[model samples]
Target chain A: MRTIGLEDIDDIALGSSLLGSGGGGDPYMGRLEAIAAVKEHGPVTLLDVDEVPDDWTVAPICGVGAPSVSLEKGTNGIEYPKVRAMMERMLDTKLDAFLLSEAGGMNSMVPISAAARAGLPLVNADGMGRAFPGIQQDTFTLNGVSTNPFVIADEKGNCTVLYTIDNDWTERIGREITTASGGQVTTLASPMTGAKMKTSVVKGTVDYAQKLGRIIRTASDAQGEEPEAFFLRESGAMRFFKGKICDVLRETRDGFNFGKVTLEGIGEDKGREAVVEFQNENIYAEVDGEIVATVPDLICLVDSETFVPVTTENLKYGKRVLVVGLPCDPAWRTEGGLELAGPRWFGLDVDYVPIEELAARRTDA
Target chain B: MRTIGLEDIDDIALGSSLLGSGGGGDPYMGRLEAIAAVKEHGPVTLLDVDEVPDDWTVAPICGVGAPSVSLEKGTNGIEYPKVRAMMERMLDTKLDAFLLSEAGGMNSMVPISAAARAGLPLVNADGMGRAFPGIQQDTFTLNGVSTNPFVIADEKGNCTVLYTIDNDWTERIGREITTASGGQVTTLASPMTGAKMKTSVVKGTVDYAQKLGRIIRTASDAQGEEPEAFFLRESGAMRFFKGKICDVLRETRDGFNFGKVTLEGIGEDKGREAVVEFQNENIYAEVDGEIVATVPDLICLVDSETFVPVTTENLKYGKRVLVVGLPCDPAWRTEGGLELAGPRWFGLDVDYVPIEELAARRTDA
Candidate 1:
């Protein structure tokens, strides 16, 4: 077990956004919320998967809805605990700890604040090793955790408990409820015993996020070097391209941001054009008309100079950024996980291929 | 005590629509579904409010959404019990009887079918003495029945449990979820004990619907009189005008049919014009540039010749019709009740004057 201090928030928040692959919402607000909560409530313990007892209940708390809406509708900081309380009511059992729904962007620290404020431990693992746009795009479903009986509460004290037959239905119905409840909500789902969570969640992703955050922070302070190159090497992410965002098409509808960004290559990657498509996160990326990255894999966009992650909602024209690709956890590479979050699931025409192979092919060419 | 048999569905369906004030849904589908259930399950026992035990749990089961959607998205005969079961799960207790959510339209018969299939008793009372499009416009709300902990289920077996602070929040959020879940959903809410049910609901409305239905059925078979006159006097309603519909401005949106119907006078009511506005149920009416009716009062539309109730959705051009108005129950006329469902609540510029008072003024003129 480890204690998450207020100082750890910056690195985790930055790393979480980097792992978000340009989705999971911007981390700025989450960082602020977490810092305030930790300062007020003191540091929080983060239990490892095995550290939790077999019979103890566990779940994740995260923000769910269109990422852009967070800016317009400032939250009351009440929905986080309400969601957890609602989950407890639904189950008639208290959760032993709050698990990270995703180790990406703002969501990663949402649980940190929730856990700290509630005096509940935070689990040092996550459902999605990295953030994915859709709720069903997690290892929990692939590992046989039921998505039934989750709680979603909006800032207005309006709450809804969702029960669906499958994970897909959870997304379909939950998204609609989120949209209906003013485009933003807090959700806690997949409640299970620590035994079930041990087998289902991606282990140590929170610590990985902290490590990535440390790399970015330390590298960010050094001058006269490409911080992104250092970030890529340390993150095991291969450099896809360095380019200026030429065009961005975006629309927020049905409680999600659906868009794509076109990148005009710069530096050593000159004369090559890349297109990255997203539904809240970068799901597919291609360069010079060749597929270089596709989910279930991480396709991260970070500022070229500072290595700070740029979320899909924050992507804009003329932003010089680095397109970085990293392999997803083995759980997502499985058949069920692939079907849950694959490029095919996003209605793309591309076939599934590992990020390493795609990078190797690009390098060989 | 009484039993609701399969034969009673026709009259109840017709009378229910009359009380719907031209809103509730078309009673045809509800009729067919209730009739089928009663035939399959024998009959439903209905207990009068006074006959119920103080401690027994009771609530209403009704349909929520745009009246138009029910025609296209046929139900699977599963959502009724699913809603009840969900409510039971939420409260963790078995309900003794099902109260009617509204006394008007298809909803009046929904609880009958639900009670019959579950073999539970149906209470001879309702929240809305006459249906008024929005959920918050019920006598139950004004009488202190909490609108929280309700269940909304779709035909697809997906369900949402809603918990809101006020009745208004229930409508705002519930409507959105209903719209999202294919524009129609089955809901059970305002759960209370028999003691609270007795004080909060309109007593004997179910039996009254049956009586009104029988009157309409008998009058339809009778020859050559203005049958609506008999329906009016027997049901304590007043005829506002007799005319042929000239124009209808209608749109189905946000899970409601919002519009107005204008009538050009005919026969004894010749040379007068009446315009009635509605949001789901008729909320206001004007005759010859004077306020004739406004809500928390029922403004029903029926065929002038046959006395068949015409829902707002069924209103069409050139159809000869009678405008009938009936006072809402005393529960909706109190200060709090009026504040909840009065003309001002519907954003009308006029004040709510009782139907009987308006009729008296017209007679004196």
Candidate 2:
């Protein structure tokens, strides 16, 4: 899509939620915010990397906190442009476009809202192919970009322009502020140039999410085809499990929603059980005590019938669902990316194995 | 004291500790830092409020965190000037002098070091006549000054120029950053004009602390007089109790040392028990089941023999000490000041009757 008009918000939000892997907070709020902005300011131009000059700058306007809180307390929308303005003044330059922080759940719509409100175009790229739990889990951190000179602002108009030693400092300080400031803050961090964006981001994830959203919407409402089956075929994703959510355990601590979900298998996989673990996003999944999926691969849960994305925060008991896994961006599979956000980085006793390999083995067995 | 030479540091440190009311961390490290600063850059001029132009700018550079942590992890000294520079840049004006945040313990020495390093005069005035646990406990907050446009920085060069809606926001956000950044941060906050400083701060507190320090030192060194008696005679301070510390419990949490000290009367009042409760600064004290003193009043613990100040962080079992009560600033007795930092504000159940009244009742009975 060349432009993100009001009508595209649902598809993009839906598509991005699938990429969210059951995290990035709920996408519904972001969708509403993006729709309102587009309606008020007209359609925001969606630009390809080639459409912008090399010198153009792009930065993400994102929120940081737990899904447990952010889902309930939606953005007031003032913090968005306040952070934007502070960033512009602090950096002593004008922003040319907005870059999505991640092509996951609600965040996929955050840049849309920010760009539309600022009357600027949005580049179809993101720091992460999908959202991860930590600030250091971004492509910008992997590509040697500093998280310094960033701005964080709360809805009450309290703001701090922070400069830290590293991304770890950025995460700790930022998280502390987020948790203390009513568990949510709008942030403008890690501004990258158009030239750097080409090499430092997961490209076209915005376009991909929008396409997937469209595919799911059209197929779900169609006469013959089913949404999940269409999504599986079009996105080349593997069905990790098909079952009903038997139990879910979620606890929000230090501004993160850590959770576990147990699914009782159904359909062809009757009489089996599947377990999924998540910290803000789904991190690992096992069926009958065998490892089936793990991050940094996308592990998404969706409604069994309508193919609507169900975030980790929205997981509930007695809900029929399908567990899906998709290959992460090629960059995330690199040695550097794996070291930065792989299972070991998250304190898990597992090695980095591509989802394609794991899914191929599961199918073969 | 017209200038803060290296020799004056010991007396200031000693005297300030008396005003500390068992808070403001420990004075030894701050003394060393101030001495080194003065030795390297010569003396820092001590300016009376009237010496500065009416339009001259003044602000406080102080440390915030648990006295338990701040005492052990003394400032690296870099953070002080860094915050000062950020405040200057953000306010877009040069500071004419440094105003001590409080006239208590280590903090009183902090401004001395900061002023010497910057080659600026240090005003004899201070925001609080005694050091307090929270940022809002200062006279500036009492006088209706805003804490916006403050700067906080850590030893590692990470800094934030913060703007909050009120002092409470400033305290929470600043404390969060301080705790997360290894539990120490230097802050430059509440810049006021020379005109405001005259009415907004306690006058001649530096001189008062220095004179008290001199009384303790000379009396302890001489063979003729006992330091504690000499101190009481000179300052018109009342001796609350003479005892040996029987038990002490201190825990550093959320960047403040919460503590309790149980003292058993040793001389003149044998078989009597006294309990003191503190959060950073001494908040309440009770002797033999009678409410003796509470906050908005100074409750100091000093060595029984030498009369050297004993900070809350340094309280230990078996130490022979004298609990002294000095009158707090007259401003702190005002309705606004009492409402801001009275006993109830620190969660104490006692009302803020001046120490003079409490001591007079005990003497009469």
Candidate 3:
């Protein structure tokens, strides 16, 4: 286990945002939230998934909602306590640790906040290597960890406890309640226990996020290099394309910012164009009208000059961005992953081609 | 209790689709699929919620996915059995009855297909009086019936059972699994109980759907009768406006068609414009650049000439449509209902208005 101090927040935010790939919601507020939590509660211990004791009671904590709305309705910071208390009440045991639900965006920071406040260790790995839109998308779904006894806490201090027979219904019903509660944010705690955590949590993600974050910053400062390049080097990502946002369309529905942005290629990508579709985060990145990156595969848009992350909703016409893609957890590359997040999964007709291959093509040409 | 016959299929399809208000998915396919099931297994028995014996084992069945995708992938009659058997296995009791999860679209018919084969009595009322995008929005969620031991059966005969602590996780994890299962059509059977059904269901929805279907078809056959007028006379609906779709943009994300469409007013609504947004069904409606009708109210768009229902995805530019609004269940107008489906719930800065007020304003101006 490693100790995480306040200094880790910024880097973790950047890395987690990259992993968000467009849909886990923004990490800015989450970072601020986590930093404030840490300051108030003290440093948190970050443990690898493998390091979790067999008896440790590890529960997941995260928020579900549109990032746009979150900005308008800042959180009440009460959900964590409510969910934590609910789980403890249900299981009749104190939570020994908190873990990230997904290693992307705001989700990555939630456990840190929860852990800091609860005086519990935080596991590094997440249920998903990248972000997915629903609860059933977690690797835990495959691992047979049910999302039951889950607690949803709203900003108004109203907490609803559901014991659904299945995960999908939880999402369906939760979404409606979430919408009704203002559609911005709802806190959920689920997939508890060490035995379950062993199978469900992706090992070593917390440290990975921190390490990924640190590498980008250190490499850039040391080499006077592009942060994006530093990220690509550390993560083995491939630069998909560089482009300028030409058009962006956004709408809020069912508690999400569902939108798309069209990009006209620039710089090394002068002759090409692309459209990056986002549901909170960019889920699909199409270059020259061909899908080059998709869900389950990490697709991040960064400032063309700085390589800093740019959220999908914030992208505007004429804003220059470099589209980068990284290979996801190999678990996500499996048949299940392809079926869950492949291009065809999004109604785009194409098999997934690694970003590396697309980048290699440019070099070869 | 009423015995449903083969003749009821046509009207059920028509009326249910109308009530679906462009969100419930295509009733045609659901109609045909159920018809085929009925043909093979005989007509399903429709029962009033009161008809259910206190001890009767009951389950609500429906598909969860992007409506367009559900139409394309097709049910092929696999999900019903999967969920039925799973529920049976989990509860250790024979499912004595089946019910529609919602009264609109394919969901209304999906249970029919299952009920016919299972030889279970089908409840007339649904959890949601109309249609909603996710699981938690149902009357069941509001009524405090957990959708647990819910079974999600995919087309490939792969079934995953999720036990979420709450309803929100069900949607997320179930959607992720559905996506992983190659975007397969899925059926979920949830909140199984006789007593729970009585409290959570919208009474008489099945009969309502059937009768609504009959009215529309009969209106078309009769000379000089308007379908909207028939709906108003029978269902207390108010004519909101008449317009042609001028622009539309949408995307299918996480198994849902979520977006917005703009309408250029025509006839009584000339020179005025509106935008209708949908998450499965029309949830927000704005007229003349002002918010008119919003959620918890039935916002419907019917083909101007035929009065056939128009789904969100099917709505295209140049299609003339009559926008109508109906007061939703009194339950929806309640504080809880407003919280669940209100305009403000969707992140819009507007208060909920009754359909009558919006309709009266149109005539006054």
* Candidate with maximal TM-score: 2
| lDDT winner between candidates 2 and 3 | 2
| Pairs of residues at least 3 apart in sequence or in different chains that clash in candidate 2 | B16-B105, B66-B255
User: For every candidate, what is the interface RMSD in angstroms?
Assistant: 1.5, 0.8, 10.2
Against the true structure, what is each candidate's TM-score?
Answer: 0.92, 0.97, 0.55
**Per-residue alpha-carbon lDDT of candidate 3 for residues A1-365, written as tens digits (9 for 90 to 100):** 77778998888887777777766667877888889999999999988777788878777788887777765676788878877886776566788887788876677887788788878888877888777777667777666677776666666655654445577666665665567566755455564677778877677777677676776556556567565567677767678788888888999877678888888888778878888887766778877766677776788887777566777656778889888887777777778767756667666667777666766776787
What would the per-residue lDDT of candidate 3 be over residues B1-365, giving only the tens digit for each residue?
Answer: 67777888877877777777777778878888888888898878888888887777777788777787876777756677777776776677898888777767777888888888778788888878888877677777777776776677666555655555566666655665555555545555565568767887788888888787776666656556565576557655567778989999898876678889999989878999889988878888888776678887888888887777787868888999988776787878778878777777667678887877876777798
lDDT of each: 0.86, 0.86, 0.75
True contacts kept of each: 0.78, 0.90, 0.00
DockQ of 3: 0.04
Sliding window of 10 residues with minimal summed lDDT for model 1 chain B: B220-229
Candidate 3 stretches greater than 4 Å from native: A1-365, B182-184, B223-231, B360-365
| Chain A superposition TM-score, candidate 1 | 0.97
Best by lDDT: 1
Clashing pairs in 1: A16-A105, B16-B105
Tens-digit per-residue lDDT, B236-268, candidate 2: 777888899999999988888898999999989
The lDDT, on a scale of 0 to 1, for candidate 3 is 0.75
In model 1, what is the error at residue B118, expressed in angstroms?
2.6
Model 3, position B67: C-alpha lDDT score: 80
